[model samples]
Target: MKKICIALDYNPNSEKIAAIGHAYARALRAETILVHVISEAAFYAMEYEPFMGYDSPFHLNNLDMVKELEQGAENFLLAASLHLGTDGIKTQVLEGETSDAILSFCRENRVDLLVIGTHSHSVLENVLMGNTAVKIVRHTGIPLLVVPTKMEG
Candidate 1:
C-alpha cells in the first residue's frame, strides 16, 4: 500500500492542506501521516536543553521562555491531531529544522508522496527569504505536492 506524508505547521491554512491530503489519500487508497515539525529555534526558546547548569541569568530566563513556547507547541499539536483525527489521518509531531525533519521522516517512512503548503510570497521575497517548499523540492527524492494557499477573490 502506498503511504503519504503531509507536513503541517499549525498554520491557518492547515485545514486546506489536510483536505488535499484526504482527497489524495482517498483517491490513491494510501495511508496518511500528518507530520508537524517544531523548529529548533522554537525548541530552544522553549528552554529544552540537556544540561541545566548554566550560570548566566540571561540564559536561565531564555530557558524559561523556551519552556513556555514548548508547552504551547505541544498543546497546538495535540489539538491539531484531534482535529485531523476526524479525517482519519495519522499524525506525528517532530522537532528540528523543518526541511530536514520532513525529509528525514519521508526517508525513514518510505513515503511515496509528500504534501505541504506554501505561504505565498513574491519572487524577490522568496529569494531573499528562503522558502521551505523550495528547499524540500530541491533536497528530497520523493514526489512532492506544493499546495498554494487559496487567494482571496
Candidate 2:
C-alpha cells in the first residue's frame, strides 16, 4: 500500500483506531493520512441541550457552530497525528457526510487502504454518526482495516 487513509471520529475510540492504522502504515512503509469527517454544525448543536437554566444551544447559530466544528476537527486531527508520533503524517478535516467524505478523499488521494473503528461513544454519536463503517465498506473500492473498538458487554 502506497497511501493509507485513517478515518477518525471525535469519539475516544478513535485513538485506538489511529494507532493501529499507524502500525499498518509503518509495516507497509506507506504514507499516512489522518482524516476526520464532520457533519453540519446543526448536527452537533443537539449535544448542547438547555442546561443550568440556560436558554438553548440553538442560540449558537449554524455559522458560529460551523467555524467551531471545523476548528475542532482540525485540532483533533493534529492531536491524533502527534499522538501517532509521526512527523510525516498528513491531517485533513473534511466537511459533509462521514462515509461520503471519506470515500471521496480515499479516491482522490489514491489511497490503497482505509482504517476505521466500529464503535462510537454515545447514543447521540450513534444517531449523528450512523453506521459509518457499513456505509464505507459498501462503497469504498480500497482495502479496509476495520479495528474492533466496540466495548465488550
**Top candidate when judged by TM-score against the true structure:** 2
lDDT of 1 by residue, 4-98 (tens): 99887867898788778767987899997878877874534443445667554334678676667667766665676576555566767677888
CA RMSD of all predictions: 5.1, 4.6
Best by lDDT: 2
* Candidate 2 lDDT, 10-72, residue by residue in tens: 888898899999999999999999999887555655555567988665556756777888898
TM match of model 2 to true structure: 0.80
Q: Residue pairs in steric clash, candidate 1?
A: 45-66, 46-66, 46-67, 47-66
TM-score of each: 0.75, 0.80
- Poorly placed runs, candidate 2 (over 4 Å): 41-62, 120-130
lDDT of every model, 2 decimals: 0.79, 0.86
Error of 2 at 46 (Å): 15
